[model samples]
Target: MTKSDFPALRMTIDGGRLVPAGPFDAERLNSYRRGTVVYVRFTEEKDRVLVRKWFAIIDIVLKQCQTPWKNRDQAHEAIKLALGIVNLSKTVGGDYMQYPKSITALEDPELQEALEQMTELLSRMTGVDVATLKKETAHIVEYEDHGPTTGEIIEHESGAASPDADEPPSSSSAGAAESPSSAAPTNTDTTETPVADLVSVETSGDGDAPTPSPGARDPETQRLIDFAKDVLPLAANTETTGSLLSAIEKEWAPEIKKMSADGQEKAKAISRSMRAIFNRQASLNGALDFFSDALGCSVEELGG
Candidate 1:
């Protein structure tokens, strides 16, 4: 069947089941067998509107800037690059090159983040504060249509969403997870493990012990600790160091959600520091050591 031949449905994840959220063609849904696979993308209507409106606003403002863009698609690609929202591919010569990553593929949390970064970029380029920028763009953005009311709960097929968001929609694409099946629900609480309880300092036994969870700490400190927990486990011996750095890079998206405007700038700085060691061997250990020096802790204390 052609792409347009498929029907779409709106649904949400409730108690690990896909519950219809709006009027759906029941006949189409019944055509598939129980084990038939489909694609799922989890994005919200509001997020889609925000992204398009921001892009339109940027396109308008760019006419007066040093680098003017007449083409909206090209402008969008440039914006993605300037904001570091890209994927890296190695060239035939073994050097890294950047290509624009799809903004639509971003999950709810990630989409909001890209909009924020786009706002900041537009602000700097236009020499305006966020409040004023919004005011100026409000009219232009309003000219665009807000996508489907009672629309399908869908995702970009790239990343996972937090537990609080809606479930993904089904598509006919193979190799993708079927909607609502094989999708595991995530926990909503962290209180089960006492913050003071000690987790292993390293995945390998050679490292130190009794690293306490930063429970009840201020949100900022706890945020970094949580990030370290997620990223540090990939570090083992020399063989596994690449996994560690890749983990750290992957954490960049969700990790910055809690950061303030100032904190975000500082994060970019720290990211640059991390990227400096990407070419070096033992980069994971170097990164952990760097974090320890910056945070005033030993390497052993770096993990969860």
Candidate 2:
């Protein structure tokens, strides 16, 4: 749902969540999402790494799929199709494909056409042509089939849970608890760059603020502050990225409200990534605002 559908705007948050007014339709949101709204508290430093990894994951996969139909490489093409099937699994239903081997379905003419269309749409939305992503991904070849289970991908990576799963959680339960996906997804690898380091609050003109005492310091909290300062400006300019994410957020409630249970679960995966990306930007913007004001400077000063 859009901001107007909720009682608060995207920026309006209370206790780290969107506080919708009264009598909202929780059915519109998937359950694994914890409650209704996405909870985005960066409780650990690794959470920031998870966000960057997710960003890299989406960006790298899209770039691999970008060439014209004839020029696409087989392995990269396979990876792209795998992602597409997984995407379908998220939006359409879990039953569409069971095993990760479902990537082989890309060979079917119908599936090929569908994936081509989806890849193109995602390409347009993410701008993942070679030039858009200049860096090389050396580990992609080695990182094959190393993600969560399909269910976990749907529940954890996808951001929202099923209707049944969400009912058990109180956060989406209208102020009883907090959304689970709000926390960053944990990573298997620790060396993945801590994006928080890149988003330094000190660079945001908070260099002069008094340092927290040793006893009060929480490294994760400080890292998150840095992450926000670094990401907000970039977030401002990513309209395509924003559009793609916005589409994902609205996928369940407005777009697939009439879909079947399986269909809805499948579709909610799309919302998962969308919410994850939005959380990164929203949290960063929130953090930058806090740091900027505290240091008596404009948010723009917080940069790489």
Highest-lDDT candidate:
1
Query: Against the true structure, what is every candidate's RMSD?
Result: 19.3, 24.6
Q: Which run of 10 residues does model 2 get worst, by summed lDDT? A: 137-146
Q: Give a tens-digit lDDT track for model 2, residues 6-98.
A: 322112236876442222223223223564555443321112222222233333432222222222233233333323233322225433322
Write one digit per residue (lDDT tens) for candidate 1, span 1-304. 8534554554666799776554354445565688988887775444454554455455444432322344555566666654456676788999665566788777668777677666654553333455654544443222221125433443322245434222222111212222221233433443322211222122235422223344633465455544544444444332556656766667676768667774465355335434433432224454554344333344676562
Please provide TM-scores, in order, for all candidate models, with all chains considered together.
0.38, 0.17
- TM-score: model 2 vs. ground truth: 0.17
* Each prediction's whole-model lDDT (CA): 0.47, 0.33
Model 2 spans > 4 angstroms off = 1-109, 125-252, 255-304
